[model samples]
Target: MATITLTVNQAIRELSDIDPTTPLLWVLRDHLGLVGTKFGCGKGLCGSCTVHLEGVAVRSCTMPLASVAGRSVTTIEGLAGEGDELHPLQESWIEQDVPQCGYCQAGQIMSAAALLNGNAKPSDDDIDTAMSGNICRCGTYQRIRKAIRAAAEKGGAA
Candidate 1:
């Protein structure tokens, strides 16, 4: 066990007597009260617990809290641009009606945001490669893809 301070959503959060081995997902959801990063599979196979570590998407379920002590973390709740200003992917999501169960949408968007941060114009193959880890039980893959493309076209991340 260790006392650690993590930078989350642009805020400094000090956690006392925390287990460093604890997965980041539980820390964010249970400790930090950032529940938008859902818990689907504890094995990290499902991307439901995906979040950004230094702007790169990672599986929060398997990531140790100790790994993020000095680094910054961004959950789905922090994806918005500014007050009441949604990220381009968020706007496209609403415009495209992408969510069905909505359980995996946050993770999907986080992963897509990472992808878009690297590739402004992601090919279909790029989208598939990037989103292969995220599983949407509601079968909203098509809509997700469309929304991603739309966000890209609108210069969401770039």
Candidate 2:
């Protein structure tokens, strides 16, 4: 057990007495009370536990807590702007009606946000390639693609 410090959602957070080998997903959900990142497959294949590490998409479930020490992590709750403002992808998501079961939407959105952050205007193939890791059991792939394109049109998830 040791103390690990990291920044989350633009805020500095310190976790004490935590095993460094502990998965970041549990630390975020259980310790930090951020439940937006879900648990799908513990092995990290499903992409349901996706989050951002230094503005890059990462699977949190298999990421060790120590790996995030001194780094910045962003969850779904932090993807928005100041005071009720939504991210472009979030707005496009709602406009496109992208959620069905909604269980995977948070991860889906996080993945989309990362893609749009890097690629201002991604082609259909680009969107597919970037989002292929995230699985939406509800089969909302078309809507997801549409939302991503919509957000891209709105200036690339700024």
For candidate 2, report its TM-score.
0.98
lDDT by residue (70-125, candidate 1, tens digit) is 88999889999778999999999999999998999999999999999999999999
What is the TM-score (0 to 1) of candidate 1?
A: 0.98
| Model 2 accuracy (lDDT, Cα) | 0.93
**lDDT on C-alpha atoms for all candidate structures:** 0.94, 0.93
| Reference-based lDDT, residue 30, model 2 | 98
Cα deviation at 55, candidate 2, in Å, is 0.3
| Deviation of model 1 at 4, angstroms | 0.9
User: Which candidate achieves the best lDDT against the true structure?
Assistant: 1
- Residue-wise C-alpha lDDT for candidate 2, range 1-158, written one tens digit per residue: 99999999999999999999999999999999999899998897878899999999999999999999999999999999999999999999899999998988899999989998898999999999999999988899999999999899989676
TM for every model, in the order presented, reads 0.98, 0.98
